[model samples]
Target: MAGGMRNLDPVIAVDGCAVGGEFQGKARPEGKTWLEGKRWEAGALRFCANLSRCSGGRRLSSATNALAATSRNFRQATRLLGLDSKLEKSLLIPFREIKVECTIPKDDGTLASFVGFRVQHDNSRGPMKGGIRYHPEVDPDEVNALAQLMTWKTAVAAVPYGGAKGGIGCSPAPDMGTNSQTMAWILDEYSKFHGHSPAVVTGKPIDLGGSLGRDAATGRGVMYATEALLAEHGKSISGSTFVIQGFGNVGSWAAQLIHEKVAR
Candidate 1:
């Protein structure tokens, strides 16, 4: 991440922790990863997680941390767009950061505690939307990095929602971890604070009014888009070489649809 900050102006300063911040009065020297004095203290600090390992062994926090990548990309984008300094800081900062303890009783009557995190980047578009992932390695820093990504992702998609991402640093039983059941639990808990609001989420079980074929909708949409683009060029997907990355839900579905069209 050394040259990652090369493109951005010196106005984007760094705090003691090396995170991005605003320069109060003096512009910090070039290539300085840390700052001192009240003039360079933190006023706003946030970055999208890089999540990819850099060339060197050095790390901001985690080995595969994401802030560096996200931050560098954002700075380059702001430079390209010629956005204002104030607006750039505003976009980098998140709207909210939340941490909570989730305790549950085990089958043997013992108790277990797992940490959870949710970072809401923005909601000015409409509602804050992101994924609620459950994994044992989930942590606050990673969650914060992901939230920043969600903000711009929604904007690029021209969606009406903002970016937000959540994750629990633990796993669940196989049955409860599936799509419908997980959504049902969320709906029930949310209803306790607000009301019976099924609209709060999507991908609920069909019994709970989840969208029909919701699981494969994204992949299907991708396939349709590809077909349309190919059609415009006087070609089709049939017998064409297609490079589909990842085997997740979206990729799998998109591949399936394209495969049906005899695409290679």
Candidate 2:
């Protein structure tokens, strides 16, 4: 319809009807407008917009729209810093977006395909650093948002690394059929182009060139952060009572460190 409308003369308003910019139950032509006296377009765009608004049952989660929030925060920071608009825009754009099809053979000798995405948000500071998450819900938008966050976080911490995030649409638990093997596959897959780059990704198993403190880094960070905050108030971890929710890898390590401090 759009192609046919192009190269045609301006569509005359039938019966001088004002263009109805909505669709009730079905789509129908309402009125038309001419673009540059050549292309004639109707109110279909508005109709589709309204239809989408009406059909949407629930609002999208802020997590799903993480990039939008990141942009807003970045814009506000840049505005307060009085940065140049051109530079601000340039910094906001991601350095690269990569999507690949990961096809792996299941135990049953059948091939299963999953979509993988990697977003490298920046490289001004140094090499990009991020994690490769394996979850069925992993998506490009979330990965992009995470990559941007890594860039900002590394810059704030004065770390000589940019930001990147990659993930595959697969489970993380071994019982559910995915685990460390997933990262190994991803590392091997990524190395195909980058050529044996271990630093290209973090959070790998110890056998895969992963650093010694990688697993405990987050918990250690929390410990130091808590210590700093307590020191500001002339208190220490041993003098405080803590309630840690969800004793996962990070939480468990943090609890152990704090307990040891109290024992000493």
Candidate 3:
């Protein structure tokens, strides 16, 4: 079979003799015997040769499948180890939803209509805790999901709080200078149903009986947590640098506290 392969078709011979179905054509010098019978099949020879020269000549399909399977396996393992199916299922319970529509007089002597919603989900632990974002896209489903997350978050933190979220579907952008007034109006409307319970929703202005330091509470909490983490390794936040992404209330407060207490 020494010269028997000499006259055989190069494609078939290469496929038959090559290990792992890979054929290396460039190792041979130009005009060599192996190149003599090599015929191009619509550039198939070049494609296979280029692939063989690659670090690993494995097909993209096999590599992709392998990566996907690995990721799936890792996710499964994490879920099995980290998640409690029964607890998660129990947490997913029916929630109470409130929807309101009202008209507020704008600065231009025009009345603008606004829609608002509040979702109270899972008060098993204590008072609910979540933010009341003011956005035009606010809806019942989004509020409910946020409330549910707050429930989980407060529980995980072992805080004495349940989960509730509320929002008004109005653009609080600068274009709506009347938005601040609308907020007060919405707060009043919500209080009619919730019975003037400022505890029901946080982040209210000080005039609305919001806690004196409540505005900065979240940021201070983050600073405390970061300090705790650093202290765990016998380190302090004296020279540690942090990059904050958001400039909202929480982010601003965190940055302020870090700069004053930790970074300084």
* lDDT (CA) per prediction: 0.61, 0.59, 0.53
Model 2 residue 104 lDDT? Answer: 85
Tens digits of lDDT, candidate 1, 1-264? 000001111111123233231222334576223422333233222121221221111223446556666777899999999999899988888888889998899999999998888888888887887776676777776667677887887798898988788877776534222455667777788889999888777778888878788777756766766666556545677876665434555557777988899976
In model 1, what lDDT does residue 235 have?
62
- Error at 168, model 2, angstroms: 1.8
lDDT value, residue 49 of candidate 3: 19
Score every model by TM-score: 0.65, 0.64, 0.54
Best by TM-score: 1
Give RMSD (Å) of candidate 3 vs. truth: 21.8
Native-referenced Cα lDDT, model 1: 0.61
For residues 81-195, write the lDDT of model 3, one tens digit per residue: 7867675556565357789999989999999999987777877897665656567766676667666666767877899988877777866655422222334555677689877
For model 2, the superposed segments whose C-alpha errors exceed 4 Å read 1-64, 174-195, 203-210, 229-235
> Which candidate achieves the best lDDT against the true structure?
1
What lDDT score is found at residue 118 in candidate 1?
A: 84
Clash total of candidate 1: 6
Candidate with better lDDT, 1 vs 3: 1
